[model samples]
Target chain A: MGQFILFLVLMTLGYLFGHYAEKKHYKSINKREKELLKLPVISCKNPIGNDTVAHVKLSYGSVVISVDYFKRILASLYNFFGGNIRSYETLLDRARREAILRLKESTTDADQIINLRIETSSIYKGNGNSIGSVEVLAYGTAIYFEKNEPT
Target chain B: MLMSNIEIIPNKTIVTGFGVVSGSTVRAKHAGRDLMAGLKNIFGGELKGYTELLEESREEAIKRMISQAEQMGANAIVNVRFSTSSVAAGAAEIYVYGTAVTVE
Candidate 1:
């Protein structure tokens, strides 16, 4: 009975707080994404054209996001149902976008970022086979030209 | 040294290629960070501690790769790639590799 009460309290807290945090983070991500629309991130293996390249460097961004107790339980229940786990979809979407935003933020002065790649990994699975957290890494090559010519 | 994920470095030309070089490191989560993460599991937020730990470990791996390229007398590393794997329960291994080359 005591364990059940604790679990109930934890689920309630997780639901409330997780919802709030997700809302806040989404707002921030949307605003920043619009602000950074000018910089192009592409997956092409090479630069577009023959331009005098002044510099080239590797840029990367990584983030680790933890699953709330509520979502973990929700996912486990979904697992038994064997359907889409809607709870984790938003979590992964947020992590990927946040990682890309950070990558763009790191190389603001660069002309373009090419050969972009994103990696996702589960960092830890806590006791009882419950997921603890996941990590996302976004990386690309930031290319700089000799001069920014006005078109 | 110049580093990029692409095959070519735009204006630079590859004069000599010194084959592939790689570096890897495995890191285990500390008890303190795990404890904090447990608290965060209820609140649901970013795990900044784990992020920083990953970044530092990656940086260390890159540094080691660069040193190896330096020994080979290479000025650049191109086609750089990164990979991660779980070596143990609570530990992650970050591996980085690239082809070392001299550019002109």
Candidate 2:
């Protein structure tokens, strides 16, 4: 009976807190995504023009986000069912997008960003029970085109 | 030395390839930073400590990789890539690899 009550309490706490966090995160992501629609980052092998005068530099963005307890419980349940555990997907998605947004935000002088790369790491600290957090890193080489002089 | 993840430098000439060079490191979160990050997590924002830890790890790996490239008589590294994995509980591994090349 004691264990049951404790479980109920954890679940309730997780539900309220998790829902609030998720909603706020989604709202922020949507707003930033809309604002950042102009600066597109891509991964391609070749540069479109043979311009050597452009300034080239690297840009990096790192994001560390935690998985809430409520989704952790739902995910473990899904794990037992032997199917896709979609709860963690949003967490990773948010991390990735946030990283990219950060990279873009820092590149005001960049004309285009290419050779993009992304890396992810999971921070697991629970006692074989759940994953605690996730970290994602997004990076790219940003090129700034220098003004061309008329020949 | 110059390093870029792209296959070729936008305008520089790559003289020769010295094959692949790589460097990696594993880091475990300390108790204090973990506790502070835990508190920060309650507010649902960026955990600066963890970010700095991973950033430091990445810099170290890249530096080692660059030193290796230099040892190979290469002035540039191209097609560089980075990857990370959870090696153990509270620990993570950062790996950086790229093709070493001599550029003109």
Candidate 3:
């Protein structure tokens, strides 16, 4: 009975805090994304023009996000049923977007970022690979244009 | 040294190619960070400690790669890539590689 009660309390706290954090993050992400709409992130290998380019540099962003107790339980229960685990979807979505945003933010002055790649992995597995966090890394080459030269 | 993930630098010409250079590092956070991350697993949020650990490890790996490139007398590294894997509980390996070359 005591163990069950502890589990219940942890789940409640997890739900409340996790929900709040997700909502807040989505709001911020949406706003920042809109503000950064001008910057183009592309997966192409080559920059279109060769003449106007000033310099190219590497840019990357990485993030680690953990799932709450409630969601972890929800996902395990989902595993038994064998379908889409909605709880984890949002976690991954947020992490990927956040990583890309950080990458864009880091090179705001660049003309464009090309050859973008995103990588994901689960890290810090505690017990039975049950308690682990998602890590997303986004990287690309940023192209800067010549400042004083004519376009 | 100039570093880019693409095969060629935008404005520079590749004068000489010195082959691939690579580096890797394995790292783990202290016990305090692990304890805090455990709590975060319950409440659900960003794990800042783990993020910092990964970033630091990646930097270290990139630095090592750069040193290797320097030994080869390369002025730039292009087509760089990064990979991470968990080798043990609480420990992660960051690996980075790139082609070292001279650009003009």
Candidate 4:
């Protein structure tokens, strides 16, 4: 009975610590993202078969994206023991939407964007700190497409 | 012997290489949902890492590319492509490229 109580206390402490750490990391990333959004940018490359080019430049702060196999196991264990996973999906969805909105506002012409690309990473430091951040950069030649003109 | 000088007709298009762009970092955490995602991936499911972030960035990059194309007075962009690289340990770059052209 004593061992069981001790284990419960340790688990609770671990959960609290993990939650605090995640919040701290998120706050820092948000601060950096704000700083990046303040910079000025322009797009200067013209697309093929079009005249008049507008340069659009965008920058993003750091984001941490983690894919932990062990975490999943723990989560499942909790569910079998009784917990929920809906919260995780909600968080990811929210992050994605916020990032998209920022990107959308950074441009003047939404119709001109083409050939888009996105990349992500999960970087780990030897000090047991893993940073997961997603940087989204959209760049395409902006041109006036004539109506009824085949692209 | 070197081949005689030959005239080459260049296409009425231009492309700017190595143009820089920016994107914003987006974060979302659902209390404790990522743990499930991690498990799902291990079970051979799709791993969507910052998908919204990637989608948004893709759009932004394309917008920037098109803006650049317009600035050059190009009618269209052809053979467009994208590439990504790490500018820093935690940051990723998405670049779009294509030939800016003016068609008659």
Candidate 5:
């Protein structure tokens, strides 16, 4: 009976906390994503214009995210049932978005961002108990065009 | 030195090439963050704690690379690239590299 009560308590606490974190993250991610739409990160590898000073530099954004215990319970149950563990889907989504936002933040001076690439890897990859932590990295070569022409 | 990942910069004369310059650093998270993160894991979301740790390390690596290029007397660094690796538990390494060039 004591163990059952403890399990209930943990599940409730985990649920509340997990829900709160996910909401806050989505709010922040959506806000930045809306702003990034204006700048438009591209993977074209080359920009249209010439006659400007350009610099090839690396900019990257990365996020390490994990799933909450409540979701973990659901995920493990699903695992035993041999079906999709939906809990992790959004975890990856948030990481990817956050990484892109960070990349954008780093290259505010650049006019166009070309040659963008995203790499995803599991940092902890869990210990078979739950999904631990995953990192999503977005990297790009940023080129800034010099506005004034050289004589 | 001016550093860029772009293949070429317009309107500048490439005087000479000094080859690639690189820097790397390894960093570990503090015990406080690790404990706090363990608690936060119950509710789970963005580990802002770890993010900040890696950000600082990566920036430090970039600074070191730039300084190395400066020491070589290059005006700019181009074709920069970064790589990250986890060298140990709770620690990750950030590396930045680029080509040094004299631009006129």
Candidate 6:
């Protein structure tokens, strides 16, 4: 009984430490992002005969995404142990929305966006309750098209 | 000869517009796990720390680049490319660049 109690205490300590460390790391990334945002916005100007087209570049960083392969295994494992998977979906959706919003701000005119592209990847790998970090980026150009202009 | 906007032409066309987008995050748990994994790899294990990080950031960056291109009223993005720089020992920057064009 004492050995089991000791194991429980140790596990609890490990969980706390893991949570604290993860939170600290997240804070640092947020700080770095703020600094990056403060930098001057850079865009490319294209010259076309008499008219010049303006291009805007927007960047979104450091979003955490769920790992499909791992999530499936985890869901089954948690279910077997009587836990829920809804939390994972909530986390993923929140990140996706936030990243999109940031991308939106990078451009002046929202209507000019075309040929959109999206990319996702893992930034960090974690253990146990802490799995990994995922990032999503969305970018496009902003242009002013003449009214009634035929393509 | 018929000309299509989607066709890739070398030297004849100039890149009218360019954009790049990137996203990155570093987590502590992963760092700890990777450190252990690296040590274990001495005996033979996959080195995935950098690979996983770069792959995720690369995808996110490319997505942002495409979105930027679309916003420029570009029908297509050509000469798309990707580059990475080590911001720190365990941290990296993934960047995607492409030429945005409105073809005739």
Q: Rate the local accuracy (lDDT) of all candidates.
A: 0.91, 0.78, 0.91, 0.41, 0.77, 0.44
Residue range B12-57, candidate 5, lDDT tens digits:
6789999989999998888999887776677688788988887788
What fnat does each of the candidate structures reach?
0.85, 0.36, 0.95, 0.02, 0.68, 0.00
**Candidate 6 residues A1-151, lDDT tens each?**
9998865655454345434543454565466556445232223323123433333223332343433333434455776788667534544554554454455455434234333345554444454534344455444333333441323
TM-score: which is higher, 1 or 6?
A: 1
User: What's chain A's TM-score in each predicted model?
Assistant: 0.93, 0.87, 0.92, 0.35, 0.85, 0.44
All DockQ scores? 0.80, 0.40, 0.90, 0.06, 0.51, 0.08
TM-score of chain B of each: 0.96, 0.94, 0.98, 0.54, 0.91, 0.63
CAPRI-style grade of the A/B interface in model 4:
incorrect
Docking class of 2: acceptable
Minimum summed lDDT over a 10-residue window in model 4 chain A is located at A123-132
Candidate 1's error at B96, in angstroms?
0.6
The CAPRI class of candidate 5 is medium
lDDT of 3 by residue, A48-150 (tens): 6664888787999999999888999998899889999999999999999999999999888888889999999898675575646989999999887787232
Please report, as a residue range, the 10-residue window in candidate 6 chain B with the lowest summed lDDT.
B1-10
Name model 1 segments beyond 4 Å from true: A149-151
lDDT of 1 by residue, B1-104 (tens): 99999898878899999999999899988999888888998889899888998999999999999999999999999999998877888788999999999999
Best by DockQ: 3
Residue B102, candidate 3: alpha-carbon lDDT: 100
Candidate 1 RMSD computed on C-alpha atoms after optimal superposition onto the true structure: 2.2
Worst 10 residues of 1 chain B by lDDT: B83-92
2 or 4, which is superior by DockQ?
A: 2
TM-score of each: 0.95, 0.83, 0.95, 0.32, 0.82, 0.39
